[model samples]
Target: MKKQQFVCTSMIPYPSGNLHMGHIRNYTINDVICRKMGIKMFMGWDSFGLPAENFSISKKKTPKLCVKKNIKSMKKQFVDMGYDIVWNKEINTCNRNFYKITQFIFCKLYKCKYIYRGKCISYWDKKDKTTLSKEQIIKGRGWRSGSKVVKRFTKSYFVNLKNSFLKSIIKDIKLSNWPETIKKKQINWIGEEKGYVIKEYHLFFNNIKPFNSLVFSFNNLVLIKKLTKVKKQLNNIISNKNIFYKRNDFIYFVGYKIVYKKKLPVFISDNINFKEFYHPFVLNPFSNIRFKRKMKRKILLNLMFEKGFNTNEIFFKRKTTYKILDWNISRQRYWGTPIPTIVCKNCGVYQERLKNLPVNIKKVKLNNNSDIIKVEKTVINCHKCNCLSYRETDTLDTFFDSSWYFLHYFCKDIRKSKPLDIYIGGEEHSILHLLYSRIIIKILNKIKIVNFKNPFNTLIIQGVILNYSYYYFKNGVKNWIRKINKPKKEIKIYKKLTKMSKSKKNGINPYKYIKRFGVDTLRMYILFIAPINKNFIWNENKIIGCYRFINKVLEFFRNKKNYYYHHHLKYNKFIIKKIEEDINLCYKNFKFNILVSKIMTEFKILKKHNIKNNNVLEKFLNNLYPICPFLVKSINNNFKCQL
Candidate 1:
């Protein structure tokens, strides 16, 4: 029988700069998995993103050039680390041919009515003058610019998720082998809340007309200053008792009071974090109360009855609405796949013909003033009307490029019919990239572009690598201080272990570690440091320990005569059985940390018995090969033994 096909992939890293310890840890975990499983792996770069654009702008180079340079450097590091990747199957999103396929997929989505143009509220970064996806927003600020992000109604293309597609996606999540934590996060993100859609009526206060509104109880009422007309009317009704406040850091509490048969108060406080009601004036029923859903429903029903509404007249049936918004894949950036669309005044929006695709981005010089859409070279005649039309200026979001890349690994012909067997990525992408990819795959399956409904059969989310970060506050400004740099004069210093990030200046360079210790030693040290799915704190002393362990292993092999033991020894069978059991368990659960510990235990047993059986030693070396390939290869060559 043919061997079962297996494919593995990791989240492609953006070529913004050097590969850090975080990148090393992510790739190494996947590498070990693929090696142990005896499967070929495909790797690539997420070459098109805001970071590459920012880096290019700072360095006075084109984004393409910057990405190319960084990928070259990073690929060398991967090679040096002995990653068993199929370079021929490798893909870079920045490649025109690759993005051409991306554009083709977009066109397919467009034709299927999955893509549409609409105005929606999205996170807008004023400094970058671009729109950000919910995933791109960090703490209500732009991830790249660190500028405060604000809600803006922008006209852009959106993927339609308000349909049975969502139900299908949710259903597939239940059937997949994804981690329960990630599955729960995606379910929460989909935010399918079942609530009643009650009929609402307007009530007048102080001769002011109240529009369609809902009623709920509130202690205090406040109005946003932006609603000048409403504020003025409210001021007259309350006799200037209304408190007004302006805050950029917190949500504004715009409250209102209405009378339906009886007076009812509604407040929109920041503390009310539940989904907004359908009516403009509403209150969170769960806020300020620790009641169960059934109790809350009873209280709401009682309130409706008190408002002179019969039980039959009140609409109490449950309805569902997703908190997750439709994906907005339009970006006003230079270093991304150009959205393959054209707009003509005489004609409507049209997708570029497949034959004319790629719509090469290299032709346009991505400077501050150069707009590719308006350029004469990019303008084309409408296929039907022959009227001149400009290409879409907005490039596709980087997430769009990533969503279907795993499929490309197996579907090289695009007409072929296979999905990736496994996909490994960071937990942070659970809701964003993972969800988007699933949606895209479902759409593709519907359109008969591929056979698979889900892209990956198995998913692995590796934990983040964190390092100790030190900061000092001076004159109300917090400065990131290096650990080596001691504060002077008894200044209060704070230290915390946070995710290794370039912006925080807390990232450890893997190259530096590799230079001090060999690449195999560094790889082994990282895998041994923590469980694959748990956050690990980087420790320098651990690096020294790993280096010492490598040296000890080399010394043992060199002095094998003194440590040799016969194969019939009683302890030999125990050591072999223990190693076999541990290795099997490690491969089954991807518990690399436990595997390393078990291997160390076996090493202790070996030294105690002085085991010198070539067969048993070869089995031990073979198991270790996946973790430290270079070290194992060297040992096999020097010892003249086949492992």
Candidate 2:
């Protein structure tokens, strides 16, 4: 019988850098699921981006060189864990073949009129002298050199995703085999609440001071120091970059605040001909951000209501307009897919054509000086008009390559695209990367470039692994501390868990951990620490507990009586049913933590009767394969007494 083919992809990490514990957790979950399902899996590098370029600048190296080195390191890390990876399908987005394929998709959209050029606000890294995405801009600092990013704007291309397109694609997403929570988030994010006034404010601070009427949005009793202060707040409300760029004499904002004498429960907003002033209630602003401070808190909460902050339950946020701004995909530093537009002497600027999709770009290296990096100087012919054009020096957003990357695996050469069976990545990407990829896929399909409207039939967002660091800050003198040796008080410093990274100094190299404790221990610990979609704090005690559990499993198998059964009987049947239910639930709800617990429980229950029970052991071990393949293999061998 021919084996069924299933396409599985890991949104490749930028090979321009090191793998953190979070990466290990993501890849491990993907590997486990694929192995359990016995499907063909693909892994590759999102190699063409900022990290590589940043490395080149700092080390006086080429992006190609830096990315290759990082890939080598990552590959070793993946292989060291005995992952069954399809190296053949491995690709680098930076490579000509892959990038050309991406450009092909871009060209298809551009031709179909779904792609539009627009100016959008972006986080400007003055130190790097480049544009950075929200992800690239770390929470409080620049992702590159820890410099604070300022608000800036740039000319960029956006896939003209329409409401019809978003609704059509997102409406039936629940029908697909994906996590319910994830699907819910996607649907909410593709929010389209119609029925609000389309008010286009012209920053009317000078002349229209108080509107010569009682300030309505705010309560009279909670009046500020003056009405001008209310104007100041309204002006400040536009400070959010997402709100500011969408403002103009034209292009009315998606929604507007509703004034009600009582709890009328209606909201409305629009930028075009669609006109209405009433709609079904969504979420109360008061409930959404009940955890606000003083002053702007109530206003922010009310705005939330106008923006569709549904307070039905804690499971998800309310739906408002799909108000997310277009991506600001330009970066100044070297080492990325060169943004495929060129400035021309006659026509100003235009995207190069499909045939010359990835225009040959000159390479430049970054010196230690952040501002003194060498810029590429070369001219490439524009595919649009065959006019002599200067190449676009700005590189494509790294997220461009990362977004919809899973689609590339379905069609390895995206230039001749295919469909993806499934996509797996960290839950952290659910909003930014996942949403962006969905939008890109929809635009590509709308433009007739791709057959599928959505990229992934199934998306499994693995949970993040937290490297819980115990910092010892005694008498204002901070010192590095390990989890195993730290005092209980010192360990308590980690108030809440977070994703591990270099700046956090909380990440542990998985290989070193795997070597210290066997592969089985490492895998088991990850599974047991948290549910498949929740974050887990990494503690050495947890690893030790996993190691201990493995030893117990081995000891039980070794000492148990050898018994075989042709078929499961009453109690056995019950056990089998429970195991099946657990597996199904684990996949369905993504409850990997509970899944591991069930495995342990079953093993302990059957320990006395399972020495030569190969059938029971096989079924049990196979279920465990996703979590700890090495342990499963070892158990299978020991039960058969072959190794």
The predictions' CA RMSDs to the true structure, in order, are 7.5, 10.8
Residues 77-117 of candidate 2: C-alpha lDDT, one tens digit per residue: 77877778888768788888777766666666666766666
- Ten-residue stretch with the least lDDT total in model 2: 201-210
Highest-scoring model, lDDT: 1
Instruction: Encode model 1's per-residue lDDT on 1-29: one tens digit a residue.
Output: 23336777788888756778888888898
Clashing pairs in 2: 57-366, 195-268, 196-268, 196-269, 197-268, 283-309, 283-310, 310-318
CA shift of 347, model 1, Å: 1.5
Off by over 4 Å in 1: 1-4, 198-228, 231-261, 266-317, 362-377, 470-496, 561-572
lDDT of every model, 2 decimals: 0.71, 0.59
Candidate 1 lDDT at 452 equals 83
In model 1, the Cα lDDT at residue 267 comes to 29
Give the winner by TM-score.
1
Give the runs in model 2 whose Cα sits over 4 Å from its true position: 1-4, 119-122, 133-147, 162-322, 380-388, 413-419, 468-497, 556-590, 635-643
